[model samples]
Target: MKPLHSKTEKALAAFACICLSAVLSFSALAAEKTYRLTLAETWGPNFPIFGDATKNMAAMAEKMSNGRLKIRIDSSNKHKSPFGVFDMVKSGQYDMGHSASYYWKGKVPNTLFFTTMPFGMVASEQYGWFYHGDGMALMEEVYAPHNLLSFPGGNTGVQMGGWFQKEINSVDDLEGLKMRIPGFAGEVLAELGASPTNIAPGELYTALERRTIDALEWVGPGLDLRMGFHKIAPYYYTGWHEPATELQFLVNKRTWERLPEDLQEILRVAMRTAAYDMYIQNAHASAEAWEEMTAEYPDIQVKQFPDDVINALRSANTKLLANYADNDAQAKKILDSQQAYLNKIRRWTSISEEAYLQGQ
Candidate 1:
């Protein structure tokens, strides 16, 4: 028989093997664990670029996590509440949400600033404000109290002014005009004596066709083509409101807290990548759709609002924003941050993008 010391060593080696095997088994189980999240989006099923952003985000997150993270998306059709996404996510009825931040302006007044403002920065400039400037911090301040975290979901670079039944010639033409315009822009239009109403996306075409609304601004050519607004409305005005219409992804704070740090990072990177992809996709789709629209419908009149009308709207927008700033401290903070950033970046935009476009 072996010496007692040798036997003791052998016993220790066996015990060590068992401990190592147990540790390896525990790690394997940990690696196999999965986390699932549910998302509610404001758009309808397969709703093109807007809907695609959510899908892209979910796919990226799942793939990046190597099947450890999975996200299920419910469109408006499934959830049956396009505008209620904010409340659902906030209440923890949904783990996440995809919608426009400005949609919640009535419920949360400070949310109005997160989406595009009238005469606001363009997409690139607004994105810079979001990531490189104080935009994200300001947004968090607005959302943190509500048990929600918001991020830029996607963007429609520069939305069209709207589809109009009649041409707007002067400021007077806006008087008593019933339009489906949402967000702070609606408030601006209200100040200008226009009746602005927010309508759900599914009902917009019917509302406009039925004369329930004299005009409506959906997205640009990218989305407008599918809605066939040109078939009914002869005139399409250029954009003024929503210069960079950014959509939002909202997360329930509780749900976010439950995610591991690695998963949280994955979600963030996925959302950001999806948002950028949607912006590029929209731009390309708009270009292609515009060509198709012009070719198929020669009668479609692409018109710009008169200088006096634009100037009047711009003046009204400024005054209304001032009123909001005066009424609410949070609004003031957000507005101040956006304006300061806009003032700084617009100089570069003018010399770079504006000059380049003019030269082209």
Candidate 2:
């Protein structure tokens, strides 16, 4: 009887050891789990508002995820391909990217609509359209073929038309004119016989100064002043194109799918909040900088394109859009949706903000 009792005690001890080992292994696996992603940005390192957006998003995501998720961003200077963000994210060379969707128009023509339109809704209205309307779904559809996801990363509200060495007086003045512009706006300008070119941001100042490009449009006074374009070009035109220029965050779909549901939601929230934050930050900075520029340089001429020029540009934009609508089914769908939403929202704007401003 004593021998049998010893055998039973040994068996029980073995079983307990097995259970303990399994529990230890489970805990170890859980402890080791973390998601790390690499991001590429179109902007150079420390590129102010644009660069800040990515930094803010990464920081927020890390804090929210409690170290379970980490993001590392490589700016244009590191990657050496400012305009190649779309390709990098698609190839999974980098897990994510920050850029403008329009930059990829040559590769994906329909992508041109995702950034902004010539006479589209403003930042607030466009945001509403994105979240509450089909804007997001349409954007996803356009990017899906490339095996990537895109989000609204930031906004530069109402971009200035551009800096010009020569004043635009009539439609004919645009003939043979060279400008640094991008997206559908470039297309619109191209229709008017202007040579619309896109050069890297770092090279813009040199190109403008050397007459490689006659005119260039960066962001508003908020960003353009820092680039020192005002020191070279004298004409500062108000915005007619890109009423709300939104930048993009590109994610590799495979990398995104691997994340746990909690981390995914946290990332989405972080990016969304950061984008809205950038919009407000830019607005405040632009206002302050605009005032500063005007005071510092009384000789800097601020002018609008003459009515004939404006009419010609607007007509060109309308005709080019019509051509897209006729040729590309997807472009037509996206444009139709945007126009419909803009019509509804601008009506509200006319009664409220426009009315209030007019009275004031």
Candidate 3:
């Protein structure tokens, strides 16, 4: 009886050991599991500054996560939907997206506020709002219901107004002027009797070359140089539309939830770093491209909209913004927040950067 009891105890010990080993193996497997994500970009493959942001982000994320997290990018050429990035990511067709938030304004009015606004803050001031003030919170309020998270992907520090087939001398010149402008700026121009349209980046050069569109505003010389817009349009107007055009990264809520805390933090760091890098890169590239453009295409006339046109645009902008605030309580909140912050920061900016530039 004693020997049989000892044998039974030994069998139970072996079974316990096997159970522990299985649990340990499962845990190890779980620890080593890899998470792969896919990103869709509004820009086509090998696009310059904008496309570089996505690649920089992905490389940083993968390296930071030690290969446990991978991101695959599909540009517009592959997806065939430059403007469909928001929908694709939200619907889980893609895990992430790189596009501008304002592109979705027609679908979500509040989204218009997250991207740069007409006559709004510059890149530094806006970045201050995003990282230090109410910007991120307000953005979340707008996107939460849609099950999306939005981050500042990159900034094209003050964009050129656009390339115009004809110079804008007066408010009358804007009448029936067909231009490729997007976001709130388009609405502002529309209010002033101009026809505003949004065209994909890849299609822009063709549209302009063929005169399907009269004018288009891409980024500054950094990007516009490659598009060969100067060859078609002579009058290159200075910026007012997008003082700080910020591109966005959209993450599906489900995808965000699935990421481990470490990976989530890694993504945030990667995005933030890439965004800053793009801003600097754009500045550098624009400087170089501007030099080359002037030397190569001396006839590319750089013009600023006349005082009357500027006044008219400002008036239209104010009225449209006021109307939006009156119609939507959320719009009111966002506009008011931006205005208040701008009022506060502009004072300091005046003393610092603006003052220094004037002295120089």
Candidate 4:
């Protein structure tokens, strides 16, 4: 008869083979399903970062899901206006959309907090709050009532204030300044005596060039380059009312739920990665664009708003928050959560980001 040791070795080898078979079987099962999703964007093929992001997101999703999921991106012209994207996603008109949360402030007053706060967190801090703090949950809570799932798409860190037809010498200069501003920031602008009008991206240049609006704030240097604001508007200002302007990817709740588990994970991971790419790209591109703009157009002047102007905007933001809290439960919740998260993270930021910037 065979020894007991020999028999035991055979049994252990058989167990190992069974485990390996189970793993392979599960992998094969996961690889069998396919999901097709749509991602809508405002910028078409020409905008480098936006287009690259959309393409990269699609590629990453497919790769991550092992070809089990594929995303097809449609530009704004393919459907209704880009500004209408949030509503379309909410109404299940599309599976996903890439846009700024602030654009939908009419539908969800609090969503702007996720994109930018008047005098709030910068890009790194915003990302910290989003991934680690309560930012994601707060944003999701605000969008949930509207039948959407929202995630951070990207950020244009600490944007250029905007282009102005004339100098903003003081708070008083803002009075009756017909400008294209959106969301709660527009409310803040209105509080400071400016008349804020909501204008879509496609129409902004003509409006500014025709003197229909006195001022306009788009994303930053890279995006502003595309808009060619430098050509029409001579005065470019800094201390962007909407600092750290974030972009969000909004998806339909029902459509998201229909995705398989692996596909869902793929989408989540791809979006998270895309957010990082966007932040880096925007930051780098803004620097290059600013240098190019100043070099090419010596006639144009770039300036920062007066300290008094910044202070007045801050005060307006405070009042804006109070007004928001009075009428909006979700807005209040988001602000509260954001405030708490900021309080927690500020300690580390003081040492890490703030100190480094100061040293710089």
lDDT of 3 at 275: 91
The C-alpha TM-scores of every prediction are 0.94, 0.93, 0.94, 0.88
Query: What are the Cα lDDT values of the candidates?
Result: 0.94, 0.93, 0.93, 0.83
Q: For residues 236-322, what per-residue lDDT tens digits would candidate 2 score against the true structure? A: 999888999999999999999998788899999999999999999999999999999999988889999899888888898999999
Question: Candidate 2: worst 10 consecutive residues by lDDT?
Answer: 1-10
- Relative to the true structure, candidate 4 reaches a TM of 0.88
Error of 2 at 19 (Å): 7.4
lDDT tens readout by residue for model 1, 1-360: 655467779899889999999999998887778999999999899999999999999999999999999999999999899999999999999999999999998899889888899999999999999999999999999999999999999999999999999989888989999999999889988988999999888899999999999999999999999998999899999999999999999999999999888889999999999999999999999999999999999999999999998898899889988988999998998899899999999999999989999999
Once fitted onto the true fold, the runs of candidate 1 whose alpha carbons sit more than 4 angstroms away are 1-27
* lDDT against true structure, model 4: 0.83
- 1 or 4, greater by TM-score: 1
**Candidate 1 collision pairs:** none
For model 4, which pairs clash? Answer: none
Q: Give the per-residue lDDT digits (tens) of candidate 4, residues 41-82.
A: 876544677667777788999998778888888887687577
Q: Give the per-residue lDDT digits (tens) of candidate 3, residues 1-360.
A: 455367779999889999999999998776677899999999999999999999999999999989988999999999999999989999999999999999999899999888898899999999999999899999999999988999999999999999999878888888888889999999999988889999989889899888888899999999999999999899999999898888999999999999988889999999999998999999999999999999999999999999888888889999999999999999999999999999999999999999999999
